[model samples]
Target: MKDIKAIAMYLPQFHRIPENDQWWGKGFTEWTAAKAAEKLFQGHYQPREPLNDNYYDLMQKKTMEEQADLALKYGLDGFCFYHYYFKNGRRVLEKPAENLLKWNDINMPFCFCWDNTSWARSWSKLGSKLTWFDKEKERVYDGNGVLLEQKYGREKEWEEHFNYLLPFFQDDRYIKVDNKPVFLIYRTDEMACFTEMIDYWRKLAKIENLEGIFILGVNSCNEKIGMDGILFSGPSAYWNPIISSNHIEYENRNGIKCFDYETIWKNVMIAGSKKNVKTYFGGFVDYDDTPRRGSQGVAFINTSVEIFEEYLYKLACKNLSQNNELLFINAFNEWGEGMYLEPDKKRKYAFLEAIKTVKEKLESVVQDDNEELTSALKANKGLSGNVEVINTNMEKQNGKFKEYYFLLHRWLQLKEENKNLSKYFMDHGYYRIAIYGLGVMGKHLIEELKNTEIRLLYAIDRNPQLIYPDFEIRSVDDDFPRTDAIVVTATFEYDVIWNELKKKVDYPIVSLAHVLNEM
Candidate 1:
């Protein structure tokens, strides 16, 4: 059965519960340390518990029970706790996680996602001096926009953190692979400091008489995390703060201001489509951490459960059984950071409903025949919906909505006309044409036809800048006469580009892949 792997619980350490509020309620008003510092100096806010109201308190077993309850209620596959502390205080990450392991003895299974970034306000910390907190609100008078400060653990502090994981490594509930426990590190680049972090982890795992657990680093941080396995960015977009190095500016198809998370999730899957890495599909309910500092003026985490269900459906179609590829969710409950899949007031059971729906659907057809699978695939052909774009003729087009609708339309009509041409070429045993689009389908066709006469010796795109002097690069708007041209589009959207060519070119415009197969 396909595992509906999703994380929907929050680590008790960062989860701050306000005195008479529900678990998901905003506990404190957003205030950064600098703002707190300024406010303290200015007498605006006072500390409730001396040092900080958000003190590390995982000792509360009651909260731990609540955390486990949220996990079970949401149909989450596992839980991940953010491991960190304020400055050089006591080690706080281990307590809550340990508590969960104890709770899981008879309850649900859980795992740990190790976030290795330094605990300074300068990096991952909210309201620290190094983010876009105050300037976005125009409240503070700092340097306006960007803040870049490097506050990581010194050599000793990192060692202490690593050492604390020994017990977690031994715990069977700790998600592991083979015999070794599996630990996920947040920023892969941070692994640079203790070049031997992985080696040390292995050595420790060996000493503990267990198959050493691996430390999977962030996909953005591709540098070796010294573990046996690595974690790929699943469905939810993820960014390696250490890799992007704090370059937060990103845009999506709608030209919306996208954080780095959106960029990776949307772009990376097709970015290196030809690469050979086995990827685990990821899913998430939402990702908005701005609440930590009380900035509620953004759509940081307004993701719809409907969209999330569609993603799960896709995973099910791809044969992601529980015993096979694991579907890692972005979080269980980073409630303070606002990426919870659990039930909330505004949309009670919305996310959990998605999980159950996907789970039930996937389980129902677990052993389905090829015909059923094919029907399912076709039914959800555009489950991601149409990538609608207004073409030059103002007609809307779908599939890969990049450009040239007229050309795309003509190409589809042409393909229908020459649908029987494939058998003709196969009878002749040889045919060839130049191929366009070096994307996923194009690459696959190229590989399949490698030994055949329908060989594509050159690949091209519409982009002029990439058009090398020797390579054939033609823009759709260009008036180049279609000689022996075969318009190979990766998907349906480009069919419009082909239709545009029909109006001008009299020569044969064929399916890019079909012609290549003939060659």
Candidate 2:
């Protein structure tokens, strides 16, 4: 249930870019917008400052490295960077991601969400105006309603764009699903060419030796396109009219929209539940784009760490209940929009701690068992027995850890349904069972069968010396003991373990997962 991956949406507009300099002023960055923000109402946070005034320059490698380390420490799965691409293969504000691709030591797993929306002056009109007075005589680029246009061209343009991104797709740190690079499109509604483009990109990815490109729409995606899934962009998740009516509007002198934070989050969860397609539910740290949209901005009030964590925990539980893979967070650092998880002066690491707390609670059982496993491995590393086996399983430990936890979850579901494993074995005439693999699954099996008629005779494990089960501990090399069945708790290696056990004992061998599967 705790296996959902938490991927945070990332904003990379921190550093000063040439286009921003031309549009806003010299040395313009997201910090400029945040610094110039005015308080919209009483008790409203404005001019939000970073912790220790750490307004980072994303172009700096050290800053990015620190960001990756901090995120990983807090248990985030990865960052989904907002990728900006415009007409004719033009990309803006790309230095941060470019540097990420170039700098291998950052250690952050990442994917891209192409924000297909054009840079329109109306939406961003609150910021400093375009200083291109003596420039842009051309009609389209003339600082009209549009600052930058999003024009999707034909095959040539698409191929050019993919060629440029091929390296990123091929990068070791790029987040992939089932061997395919996961690519996100922020607004598939605006992309008329999405179906063709993604289909083409998938073919391109295959030609590059990739399985294919895994596409997930950030907002509304055309379901016919075979998008791998859809991610609900939260805080204003498409702002459904029916749900938007639930907003508890605040009386403000300005005409900006005010939403109850809790209401928006509830809407997010409800929206995800109704979706028939796969969805990675999203959450926001906070939302107030007054800096970017001024009085026209949309703000969600009554935000707190406690409330965020509560909804986030609920979101995780919801996703897990539905078998969703990840729960994405909005804006890891979108300071301009006032949505960020990076430490700030007002709430230094509270948001990050919130994520950590949720993850810890979700992985409580896994962590406890993992801690013991770690200690056991460390203590027995110098020992003569099972050293080779331990070394061999080291590479598979991470994947096996999750696999075991999944079985634990399945077992719980069966218990809730009154389909007891003990009853299943008893019904099949297996009164005595030996648990194979005394790690987490084995320990859990023993606990489940305790005091039940399905007696646990002994536990067979690789490192029998390390495990202190109530029953006798025996290595696979030891003489076989007669039992009704041997439940192989190390599900990943069930076949190999089963074969080994079958040669020595006449007992039936079954995987812990498969036992639940049959039941």
- For candidate 1, the 10 contiguous residues with the lowest summed lDDT are 387-396
lDDT of 1 by residue, 1-519 (tens): 333345433454443433212211334222222223222122112211212223334466675565566566656666656664323435433556766666655455555675544332332222233322333323322232222222333335545655676766666666555555656666543222323345555565676687766555545323232434445444333342222222244433222233433444333222121012232335555654333443321223235567667755664554242132356666554443445564454566677778877766666666554466556545433322221111111211221242234333433544555543344345543355555565655555555455555545355566655544424665645556333555465433333445555577665555543332222
Q: Which residue runs does candidate 2 get wrong by more than 4 Å?
A: 122-143, 242-253, 272-276, 365-519
- Residue 361 of candidate 1: its Cα lDDT? 68
Model 2 has an lDDT value of 0.72
Off by over 4 Å in 1: 1-4, 14-59, 85-90, 101-106, 122-162, 193-195, 221-227, 232-278, 293-302, 316-324, 369-519
Clashes of 2: 0
Pairs of residues at least 3 apart in sequence or in different chains that clash in candidate 2: none
lDDT per prediction?
A: 0.45, 0.72
For model 2, state the Cα shift of residue 148 in Å. Answer: 1.6
Instruction: Give me candidate 2's TM-score against the actual structure.
Output: 0.66
